[model samples]
Target: MKFFLWVALVVFFSGCNNSEKENTEINGDIVYDMYKPSEMSILMNEMYDYNLKIKQEILEGKTPVNFPTNFLNIYTAELSEFKSRNETFQAYSSLFVENQKEICNTDAHSDISERYNNAINLCISCHKTECTGPIPKIKKLLIN
Candidate 1:
């Protein structure tokens, strides 16, 4: 009787593990990481790196490279749907759409400065509503 009880408990726990695995790979999508404060911070770091690369391009007298590519790839790659909410990353992404034109166009060098400032501003704005305390770093990204 005791042996049978132990077997049943093991079976129940094993089934739970299987379900958890299923949730991780939902509908062919691999949920790498969900949108949270930590993940967004990392995504923001990618944006900073992209900004540096764009600066290099400007120094060499070339067009602005695709900043969105670097930012979005890292952001999306780390996003997964939460239990109910869509994802906090959407906030950053929503603001990104407005800057897409400037971000993708090398011809927008003169415009890129404002666009860069706007991008940093939006990052702070959204993070304020979602995750505050990173405003200092975000503000530093804005052009003087």
Candidate 2:
């Protein structure tokens, strides 16, 4: 009986530890799963800030010396992986990526500003569908 009790306690404690590693326990009965942002989400927000600067330069009639091309390279791969999981996200990402590439390739101020406006529109379209909280800030990217 003593040996059996020791084995049971060891097994129970090990199982408890493993469960704790996977989830947070609340009220001894409820578990609230934790959510970590995907790599693409973090990269997207960073690029949004950079693109906002590009918008500002356009507004001031100043050409940007640097365009954030690396953002496209890094996020595209992650977006591909994420796309396999969520079709809606994939569709919006495709629109955003294509215009962003055009923005980088544009050299003439007239063309660059037009392409940047198009890219900002894509951002607005996507956010309107899934994440509406950023709509006001995104509107700031518009030329008008």
TM-score of each: 0.51, 0.59
| Per-prediction tally of clashes | 0, 0
- lDDT per residue for candidate 2 within 4-75, as digits (tens), equals 554444434332122234345577843434334456556766877888777877778766665566665543
Q: What's model 1's lDDT at 32?
A: 32
Model 2, total clashes: 0
Which lDDT tens digits does candidate 1 get at residues 1-144?
Answer: 864554444434332111233225568854432223335346666676776566555455566654455455544554222323246657566666557446556555556566666666776666665545455656665656
| Residue 134 C-alpha lDDT in model 2 | 59
Give per-residue lDDT, candidate 2, residue 86.
Answer: 61
Query: What ranges in model 1 sit over 4 Å off?
Result: 1-40, 52-63, 68-70, 73-91, 97-101, 107-110
Worst 10 residues of 2 by lDDT: 13-22
* Pairs of residues at least 3 apart in sequence or in different chains that clash in candidate 2: none
